[model samples]
Target: MEAPHSIISIISSLLHIYILVLVIRVVLDLVAVFARSWRPTGPVLLLANLVYSLTDPPLRFLRRRIPALTLGSFGIDLSFLALWFGIVIVQYLLAILSGLL
Candidate 1:
């Protein structure tokens, strides 16, 4: 059987990769919003579309179930941040549990 530390290492690595993907998706969306005038064409558009397609399903579901917070005129996407933090917390918990095991 594989060692427990090795299993935890693998899980941690996967979680890190998942977080990186989420961060990339967030960054792309921010860029798309800020650079609206710059047309996303060819490979750039394809990459942006791919990221959105992959990330949007869970985000959309969370957004609907979670309430949006209003800060004066602007509303903040609490769900997005919550999801990001939730993932981090879960990763930390897994790491701690793995250490104990």
Candidate 2:
């Protein structure tokens, strides 16, 4: 029981951290949209690439199924929001399974 609980706890924590990384990715992307001329270099570029690698696969899957919403000149990508909610739901389920809820 302890072993399973510990594993669930670890997974829940990792999912939470991934959500935070996704948020950072979103912020960076928004900044990039506004400041098109400001290109990331060195560490910033590396970080951006890292975030993309971690996030892209799942997002691409969602993007294929659900296109972004466009309003006039602005567009909103719903993949991130969807992923965030999915992660949270999974975390909640894990918590319940572990009897932490």
Candidate 3:
């Protein structure tokens, strides 16, 4: 018989995928910052919009609750970092409970 996957394993896997998605969203936003003039066309724009829709909720929530990192005229949104940290901590705790780490 094949070994069955545990619920913790599935949850951990989903967490990992979500982490990647969140990171991609942040990286896309950062690149857009530098290349503001470039605009995506066709399906590219659709994909970008999809990512924006998925990632915006948590970012907006954190942005409202936490102050951003800033120096002089420039400011960096730390919500992405906060979200990533929070996800990793939960993943870590779950792994510990599952005895996978």
- Candidate lDDT scores, in order, read 0.82, 0.89, 0.82
* Candidate 3 wrongly placed segments (more than 4 Å): 1-5
The candidate that wins on lDDT is 2
Give the alpha carbon lDDT tens digit for every residue of 1-101 in model 2: 58887888799889988988898898888899899998899999999999999999999999898889999998988887889889989988997888852
Candidate 3's displacement at residue 91, Å, is 0.8
Q: Quote the lDDT for 41 in model 3.
A: 81
Q: Clash totals for all models, in order?
A: 0, 0, 0
For candidate 2, the 10 contiguous residues with the lowest summed lDDT are 92-101
Instruction: Please list all clashing residue pairs in model 1, or write none if there are none.
Output: none
lDDT of candidate 1 at residue 78, scale 0 to 100 = 80
Model 3 vs. true fold: TM: 0.82
lDDT of 1 at 46: 94
- Answer with 1 or 3, whichever has the higher lDDT: 1
What are the TM-scores, per candidate, against the unseen true structure?
0.81, 0.89, 0.82
Please identify model 2 stretches exceeding 4 Å from their true place.
72-74
